[model samples]
Structures are given as structure tokens and as C-alpha cells.
Target: MKTRSKIEDEYWGALERLKIGKTKVVDTKSTRFRITKDAVGREAGRGKGYVRYERYPLLCEAIADAEVARKKNGPVTPSSNAKIEQQKALKQKAISDYNQLKQAYDMLMTEYLNVVRRNFELETGLAEVKNVKIIRMPSVR
Candidate 1:
């Protein structure tokens, strides 16, 4: 079986190819979870993310993986929808954590790249400096 990190990497890489770029699934304690977007990254809360009974692709995948892992581990829980749902939620929590980590990692890399690019441009007199003088200081990012 693939490691959880491997699965998460594949999922994040797939998400990176999107025109929208990023997405998240949040399962709130309350009914319905909705997706929120901004000029920055995407956001979704558990239970508060989608409408009632709405199914999301990533969320489904997480649930399925959780179920499989649970089954493979041997101590099988009762085959009830409620039990399944609870397990799925637990699994989804792990996925959500990894998703947030991936998003933060992406954001950090992007910021670092931009900082490097900006520093390079300033040092080489490529970026517009107008009246401002940029000193070649050590990189902080």
C-alpha cells in the first residue's frame, strides 16, 4: 500500500494543475459545509463546507481510503451507515490536515520564489526602481 504522504502528494499535485489552483474540504460540526474563495487560496469548512448530503470528489476519495485502511487493519466495525460516516469523518480530518499543510507549503514556496526573483531583479537593475534605491542586502526569506 502507498504511504499516506505519497497519496497526499499525488492529490496535491493534481490540485496544482487546476485553473482554480487550490481547493479544500472542511467538515464542520454543524450541518452543511461550503467552499469559500478569495484573492488568495481556497477555503472550505467541514460540515460547513457543502450543502446537505453533497458529495465532493476529494472528500469521497478520503473517505474511501479511510474505509479501506480500516478494513485492511482487521478489527472491522459494524457495517452501519452511521459508523461508516463517522469513520469517514475521522479519515477526512487527516486528509484535511495534509491539505492545509500542502497549501501552506505551496504558499511558502511561491513567496520564496517571488522574493528571490524580486531580489535578483533589484540587484541587476531590471525591476523598476523609480526614485527608490534598493540595497543588495542579505536575503531574509
Candidate 2:
């Protein structure tokens, strides 16, 4: 099995080729985790920007080596299953957040249109602004 540092080197090198910037790898007995650098590096032989695919293989190989190591040394607890669960929670939260934003935006847009329509009615000498209805979507679909 490859050493942890060797695996990390391979992964970072692959990322470099792929223009994925830099990453820092932390290794425990059972699993390896990579922390990507905040800043991305520029692409080679190009004008600007970074590329992700260039270094994918390098990262994959490093991860594969880590998995092999994990098989030999058992699983890592705090970082493995916990991370999966955390990701799932984050995904659900994101969906909920998106729904909330969409609802707020819809309401605001409707109110803006209603205001405009009320202004138009006043300009055209109409009475009362009681025709607007904001309907909530049915919960069961």
C-alpha cells in the first residue's frame, strides 16, 4: 500500500494537471481527507481560469489508495459516516432554503404587480383595490 504522504502527493499532482488548484490532505489510520485550497491556480498554456478534469485521475488514485488502506485498517468513525449524514442534512436544508426563497420572491413579485395595478386604477379613475388575491399552493400534491 502507498504511504499517506505519497497518496496525497499523487492527488495534489493530479489536481495541478487538471488546474484544480491545491489541496491539503490529512490522513488518519483508516481514511484520508483532502482540504482544497481557497485559491485556484491558473490553467497551463491558456489565457485565464482553471480546469477541474485535468487532475481528476490523480485525486481518484489517491482516494483509491486510501480505500485500500481503509480495508486493511478498518473504517474511520468521526469522518466517514458522520460526514455522509452531515452532507445529507446540508442538502435537505439547502432545498428547504431554496423553497423559502422562491416563496418569498413569488409573494414580493405579486405584491409589486398589485401595487402597479392599483396605481393604474387610480390614474384611470377607478375605485377600490379589493380584487387581488394571493393564493397559497396546496400542500398535498
Candidate 3:
């Protein structure tokens, strides 16, 4: 089981992205962002929570300001912004790890399939070294 790190927050908090319906200036033409409906309705579902569009930048700024303030104080608790940044970093790392694991799984599956095919071929006498070798004592000389 995965264990939390020293810096990891006891509670894993999250920010929700808006599901956009139309083309936006910031996103690619195919993709867009918007506040989801269920979230707007405050639906109590896992990972269904949402935050205002404006709050993100404000939180980021607060986190940055906290860093500046850190020099004055020895070690203060992280601001909301800093926690958000840490959450994002952890998410990105998780995604990277998932991709690598998926790639490895795919490769191993392919190799297994190939081995099965070769075994089938061998059993059906369709592979190389088709005939079994046998030794005779030359009619007892």
C-alpha cells in the first residue's frame, strides 16, 4: 500500500476543472473548459467538487506571498496556494507513472501473445527443426 510522505497533506484536497462546451482562447480548438453542471448543483459525489475560476490565481498568489513571508518566520504551515501547487505536482507525477506502467504492461502482453503463437506453431509441426532427431547403433556393426 502507498504511504504518505512527510510533506504530504493529511487530507488530500482537490480543485475541479470546468468542462467547456465551446472553443476558448486559452485551450486548444478541440478542448475547452467550464464549470460542470453537477458541480454547480453541489452534487455530493467523489471528485465532483468545483472551485470558482477566479480563485485559482488568487490562491497561487497567496502561496507565492507565503513563500516570501517564510523568510521572516522559521517554518509556517503552507498556504492554500502552496498546497494546491503540491497537489498538482503529485498529480502530474502520478500520470507519468501510470503511462510508464501501461506501456510496460502492453509490452509484456505482446510478448506473451507471441510466445503462445510460437508454442502453437511448434505443436502443429509448423516451426523450424520440424523432425525429431534419433540415434541408431548402425545395426550393431
Candidate 4:
């Protein structure tokens, strides 16, 4: 088992390598960044086997630093602009979709309330009719 200090040293080393462009950050499926040794094509934080990078506080700090470095050094490209535009369009579409769904829900709720009101009125009318029928019943001698 490795000591905490050794693991922290590894993370700091990875961060230094990332700053110098020797290591690159790869995004995981979970949207977390992982530093990779570009020359070896393996992850930096992993010492011997699988290492959960989030377990160490230093590793998370190192990843955050690396991400900041990447953003600072990365060049703005045409593709990045296109991605921004795509995100904006998606956001607009989602807002429009939510508005439409909200309108439909409001209309349905109104109709439902009207139905319930009508049902209650009918039920009360039926009960009144039953009371009248009972009052009109002839007494048996």
C-alpha cells in the first residue's frame, strides 16, 4: 500500500507534466478529467493498478489546476465556436419545448378541474333527488 504523501507527490508530478505539455488531460465518460502520460498512453495517477483519482484531495486539486492550465494554453478554434453555437441552439430549443409542455399542462389542468367540478355538481344533484324521494315516501300504517 502506498502512503498518502507518495500519492500526493504523484499527483503533483502529473500536474507539473501537464503544465509542460508532456501529459494531456483526457475527459472521462463521467465528465471528470484524467491526466494521461502522453508518451506511455496510461493514466498518471494510477501507480500500479486502478486508482480512483477522486479519493485523494491532492489529485482533485491537481486535476483542477491542469484544467485551468489547459484552458489558458488552449487555442480558440473554429470548431469551438461551432460548439458554442450548437449549445446555444440546444438551450433555446429546450426552453421552447418547456414552454409548449407547460402550456399543454395548464390546459389539461383546467379541463380536469372543470370535469371534477361538474362531477361534484352532479353528485350533489343526485343526493338531493334521493332526499326528495325519501321525503315523498308514504307512511305504512
Candidate 4 residue-wise lDDT, 25-119, digit = tens: 43333333344333112345454433344466555555566667666766655698899999999999999999999999999999999999998
Model 1 per-residue lDDT tens digits across residues 34-135: 222211113322233232224334544544554455347544446799788988999999999999999999999999999999978767684365666665
Instruction: Give Cα-based local distance difference scores for all models.
Output: 0.49, 0.51, 0.45, 0.61
Ranking by TM-score: 4, 3, 2, 1
TM-score of 2: 0.34
List the pairs of residues colliding in candidate 2.
14-55, 18-54, 18-55
List residue ranges in candidate 3 displaced over 4 A. 1-74, 126-141
TM agreement with the true structure for every prediction: 0.30, 0.34, 0.37, 0.40
* Residue-level error in angstroms, candidate 3, position 28: 49
- The per-residue C-alpha lDDT of model 4 at residue 2 equals 60
lDDT of candidate model 4 versus the reference: 0.61
Tens-digit lDDT track of model 3 for 1-141: 865432122111211211221222223122232223223223222233232335344433433454344345434568999999999999999999999999999999999999999977865664345466433357764
Instruction: Give the Å shift of residue 105 in candidate 4.
Output: 0.3
Q: How far is candidate 2 from the true structure (C-alpha RMSD, Å)?
A: 15.3
Where in model 2 is the C-alpha error above 4 Å? 1-77, 126-141
Ranking of all predicted structures according to lDDT, beginning with the best and ending with the worst: 4, 2, 1, 3
Tell me each candidate's RMSD, in Å, in order: 22.4, 15.3, 19.7, 13.0
| lDDT against true structure, model 1 | 0.49
